[model samples]
Target: MNDPSGPDRPPAARPRVRSDLDGLPLFRGRAAQSGMIRLDCNESPLAPPAAVQAALTGAVQGLNRYPDNAAADLTARLAERHGVPPAALSLGPGSVGLCAQLIQIACAAGDEVLIPWRSFEVYPSLAGTAGAVVRRVPLTAGHALDLPAMAAAITDRTRLVFVCSPNNPTGTSVSRADVERFLAAVPPDVLVVLDEAYAEFTGRQADPLDGFALVREQLRQGRTNVVALRTFSKAYGLAGLRIGYCLSAPPVAELLGRVAVPYAVGTLAQRAAAAALECEPEVRERCRHLVEERERVRAALLDSGWDVPVSGANFLWLPAGPAAEPLAAHCREQRILVKAFVGEGVRVTVGTAAENDAFLAAASRFARTEAAAPVRSAALG
Candidate 1:
């Protein structure tokens, strides 16, 4: 069979990927499309604000020219919002993109990057790509990140730690006190990234813990290693545009900028993000609406006997354990898509009212079907 194309048929052997990558899984999630209620990616179910739409419309005319590589306007607007100097900001294609760049800036081969297990799916693979070894500490019994365990795992090799507050999938946030203690315990040389991609949702909470404020306070107290990550993708409804930025000490922000790809944040994305910021009050109101919907959805699930977490983000986590896949499949059959971790759980983003109602109906059906099924041992007997 090989002889049919001669000795060169196979071409040169493709260069092998790094050995460390052999078993690591890549980031996998559902993409946006028409005619489906996408509750898998934790995206905002709302449309972008009017101002953002207008900005993007105008930005299209500027496509002939290169985007502002520095993204100065967006950065300055974000700086003012976060009460940081413009020099303390760095923009990227997305917060996840910045996560990869941050690893590159702070880590080398054999350096350690620590993150919580069952957190954002991107951290492990991205850190690996940056030549850093990843260490995953398990979440606590309550499904919150085990910050104490993470602090205990830090070694001389540990150069970076990611704290995904209102963590993905599980949707639980770490308390400010806990994070502050964890930061205090860790070596000052190690960078602690407080990823607050879902911070806006927490504002309506009974006792709000602001990740940006936490970072600012720590920096004010002279802890320069802490950084806060945010995005326009969630609350701002700009997931399609892929714009996010980080707030950090000036020196660290400079390093982050160095690793950034030139023109990574396009003109449309930058303008849209800036415009989104201008609609902060409106955005907060949208977040509050989502929060209300989230609580309602969780209550319905709880009433239905499903164990759901208290989500700080605009999603619900159903720890279905071995039944996770079956439940997810059931939802798919009903035309609803949710993110499922095989053998662990399902994460369903809170969608519009009608979408949530449809999902609830499907969930009810699934529960009924499960209840009506015969017990395995009894049936066998």
Candidate 2:
């Protein structure tokens, strides 16, 4: 119930907005600039492939026409690709946007939504919008979602649980076995949202769980509470277009559609996403390169004396403890921007080779400064 807007609201404007809206935390990544290496947001370093570019250009000609609110082409394509009926799919502006809609579909005032702390930054805001109580379960010591703990935290009021696999920022993925165990323990009526936004980058990791596959299996078994959320933002490089989809039981998918805004997804996004699907080989290649860069960057960070986690996504977690902000500041000073969680840690995205090298240089400088500061203070003492 903490206010994201703090206590500075003008008295006149306070009553105009819902109490819940007054304190909703907004994402605050730094603006992109020329010559700056953005290692903050977990976005793909590559642009959409030539096919998408062509589709986008052609699609621009139809700007005067309204978009397909159903997102027919994209949804059908996704359904066909995943071998699921179109009824089980729900499309939206992006996975984050769909997360909000899903919350609206399942939760009401006084309900509760359980989320892993330090997972996706948007979870709290999404829950808050629905006037749901936010329950943040802390991650395990290994920076993984403690599924057992999360299951333990559930109550009669818990209506939804968000499980971000290959979890954002932390970059640790949940295995199929772990997910199976967690699902078995949770209440069958309570919806579990498995966010696999980073799944494409997780293929090289050990036994990465296919979230949609799990959802489909659950649906086949008549378990309708599981939903899988995915996006074209990361691996597909369609962040600007804002296209994402959800796989769920037909009933849940229907509810999601009810809460979604009509024509929210633009035409360009749908066309681009379909075109991106057509260029699957290109997407796979980009992911392959990013995974390689992720390993190289992670190894470099570890060698540099940082406690970088073994990541299954396109980013690395530097658990800098108290030095998190200081290190982030140092990186920014070196013209590199990384996502910092204040006292928690920093999430550095794996950009292109040159961008990664730039971040490495910044990190090296920060390490040297940190190393020398204590010695200098001791000498003075």
Winning candidate number (lDDT): 2
- Stretches of candidate 1 above 4 Å error? 1-10, 31-33, 203-207, 371-381
Off by over 4 Å in 2: 1-15, 371-381
**C-alpha lDDT (0 to 100) for residue 315 of candidate 1:** 91
Separately for all candidates shown, the number of backbone clashes (residues 3 or more apart, or on different chains) is: 0, 2
- Name the TM-score of candidate 1: 0.93
Could you tell me which residue pairs clash in candidate 2?
4-23, 93-242
For residues 1-381, write the lDDT of model 2, one tens digit per residue. Answer: 646567854444434568667788986756758888888888888878988999999999899999988888888899999999999998888999899998898899989999998899989988998899999999988899999999999999999999998988899988999999999999998999999999899956566799988998998899999999999999998887888899999988888888889888999999999999999998999999999899998888777667777788889998776677888888888888898897788899999999999999888887778533432343245
Scanning candidate 2 in windows of ten residues, the lowest lDDT window is 371-380
Clashing pairs in 1: none
